[model samples]
Target: MKLPPWFRRRRVGVAATLVSVAALTAVMAPLQDDIGLLNEGLLLLLLTLVISGTWGREVGIFAAVTSNLALNFFFVEPLHTLTVQSPENVLALFVFLGVSIIGSSLLAAARASAEEARRREAETQVLLSLSRAMIGQTEPAEALASLCREVVAAFDAPGASVLTAAAGGWGVLAHAGSADAGRPADAQERTMAEQAASSGQITRIGHTGLGNSRRPRIVAPSGTQRIREADVGSAFVPLLFGDRTLGVLRLDGPIGATPFAQHPDSLLAAFAGEAALGVQRAELAQAASHADALRQADEMKTALMTSISHDLKTPLAGIKTAVSSLIDTSVEWSDEDREAFLATIDSQADRLNRVISDILDLNRIESGVIAPARRSVHVASLLDDVRERTALVTKPRVVTLDAGADIYAQADETLMAQALVNLIENAAKYSAAGAPIHLAASAAGASVEIVVSDEGPGIAARDLPHVFERFYRAQEGSRRVKGSGLGLAIVKGFVTLSGGSVRVESAPSGTRFVIQLPVAEQAKASA
Candidate 1:
């Protein structure tokens, strides 16, 4: 981080003062300047080394040898002579000189390495926080905005920029700092951003004469260069997902820094991966949102159709009954022929009624006119209840229950049972007679799961995601089923509202529909 210029000066001044004092003391200290008394000056040099090494290695070395010379010249018995006056002084002086030189340099290097490590650690933490914040963000604009602001705060930079590819060119989706950072991008910069987006290469430049092949053509404010050589010692890190360049993270160094330390790129690479994930998540969320809206509209259309069927079927049933009565004409018609005509009319009218009822119930649940009332319900009991209701169809299918009989969850008993019925009926309607449907339940940490597995040609992979969507019939649009396609949607709504979730897993072997509902807490008052 860049501090105010005054603060930096204060720090430098303090260090220099300490170094100067250490040097002065080493030179002036009293030393018996004789060949045998060389130890005194050498000891002074060692003191200077430990205290002054980090300030400057050269200063430490200079102070040590210079003090020895001063001691020999002034304190030696033969005054003003170059001789140490004792051979011992010569050996001690040589040892002190070597120690000062090697010790200070090593010490300085170690200190620099430690400080650098600390800076790198801090930067990593900031980048990690940014990545975490961006997760689960599905909107590109919001994701970009978050990325820009985070990097700005992390690096303490003057500004930050996020450039993304767009129609026919590049675009600045978000920015933080000066130059109307968040406003529309300049035309030329937008073009360059697009190119960088395509190449997926980092483009860094200072506010000097240099730029990458496709330079930043935008101008800065008057009197201050648009790309100031110092502040704009720029870095352009491309956000990539394999061959695709999702965006670019552009940062300007702190104001007045002379070539800031080169920030590591591995951390930057990790950040890019996180950003790409954010973009992907945002896109998925957006698509899901649209799909939801369309699904509601489709459900409404199905309800309209169901209502029409009901309105049309009621009168048709009366007409068919009257026609059957007239065909008999007080026992004039053949019994077999009359029976066949009446059966056909009854079957078709029943189909119409089922469709209408399904539509009405779906609309009620989904539109919130009738909300599911959730309570602690036993899973096995719910299944048995549905089985009884669906017995007429399940008798031939040999429906079986294989699950924890004691399992329970907080859910609407009626709605949950209805969901089970739909699943069983769905199996019966699609699968051949005598093909069994298996109902199972188990506890998994926070949730109690119920799975309904059936031996039927499972849903296709492409269609799996759309199964819960309304009117998403695997059958073609024009085909008719005695259903409104609203049951699964209602099931989903009820399950979700009750703090539960559902997923459809299928394979060539069969289809397994899983429902995960939160377990009811055992408490004295809250339960």
Candidate 2:
């Protein structure tokens, strides 16, 4: 709406105040006593000239004319009037008045130009600082907060803060100016800030309500004890990493505080992007390192197990042969002595053979060789065979397989038995030998899952991720139980060759190993 006449007049009065001092100084210039005040007149005139553009060219001209009239009336001899007294007075008056006006205007204009240049420079500096801080930050949090703080300080804003978007809500992270009378932090404000942030909207609140009161955010105050709650102002700059909105930059300050001298909206987005990329990189690196370590450890364990199996078998086989030769058609000592010798040989050979077999079976699986093959075998029947074989290593765990009409998995029966046997053996080795080892199989969708569960101390949390890797005995402490770490690795490789996947889940109760394979077409048809 157009201002009323009175309001227009009032504005004119306000504008007149800008140059009134210059006008008065010029008016006193003609008085001989006021001659010294001419310098004051020049100074005032200069000030007026400097700020002249703020009003307009008309204001500037009025200032110049007023100063000249005052000089002619008050200082040129006959005081309080605009009459020129004599020729010398005329020249002196005109020269003095004209020089002052011209000089003032020129100097003022120059100063004004310099001031403009300085302001532009400050803005450029703000932009540069904002740009670097934003771009350098691959992680958005610290940088965004710093950006707001630095920019506020650079532009002399009151305070700075930032709010970011998070799952289900937002997070408020801010810095304050000096204390003032205001509400202390509370959950209410936090919730509001978070909600606004999640919405990815620029929120602002001022002393006089610049924006919605529900979620007022702006250039908030910096460090201070007492903030006048009424004077609080806030603003939110949404952090956009790409097409997605990553978060928001929420800040607040005292009322009337300005934003960064030159607000660079684009810089905020850049900082968020950097943060996201850094976080992603860190996660990927961790995953890759874990996988690599497991692979190396498994390889080492496989080699060691194979060597041990071979070493043990060689001596055991020789001993067995020598004992047989003693028993069969050879000159012998007393009956008692021969019997004792034979018994000892038999016991030792049996024990050695069991150990050698376990090692060889594990090694063979790791070396990618399937065991002795035979005719069609029932899953239940094969499990029983495996249970018997596993008894030689660690006593049979509570082995169980459904009595269903011999569900068949097409593979070398012996190899399948060996794989299952190894798995059972491993469960016993890792846990107490007598632990209830549960085995279950079921047809789920198109695949069959065979899960072996042992009630032993679950693997260590740190080691759980690598339990399948050979020689990875869940820890680095006293490794009392010795084994070719190849058991699990072999099992894994065998199961994989049979076209399947294996996974281990360990919790406080016990560790569970699950193997899933695509059942043969016939098995699927039955299901």
265-317 per-residue lDDT for model 2 (tens digits): 33334333443343344345657779889987787667666657655766567
RMSD of each: 16.0, 16.0
Model 1 bad stretches (over 4 Å): 1-175, 178-332, 475-482, 521-527
Give the Å shift of residue 159 in candidate 1.
7.3
lDDT of 1 by residue, 96-198 (tens): 6677667767776776576568767777687778867677665776776687777666655677776666555456667777775544555534533554565
Total backbone clashes of model 1?
6
For model 2, how big is the CA root-mean-square deviation?
A: 16.0
- How many clashing pairs per prediction, in order? 6, 44
Residue pairs in candidate 1 whose N, alpha carbon or C atoms collide under 3 angstroms: 35-85, 35-86, 35-89, 138-282, 207-229, 220-226
User: Candidate 1 lDDT (Cα, whole model)?
Assistant: 0.65
Off by more than 4 A, model 2: 1-378, 381-403, 406-418, 427-440, 444-447, 451-466, 474-480, 489-513, 518-520, 523-527
Report lDDT (CA) for all predictions.
Answer: 0.65, 0.57
Worst 10 residues of 2 by lDDT: 255-264
Judge candidate 2 against the unseen true structure and give its global Cα lDDT, from 0 to 1.
0.57
TM-score of each: 0.43, 0.38
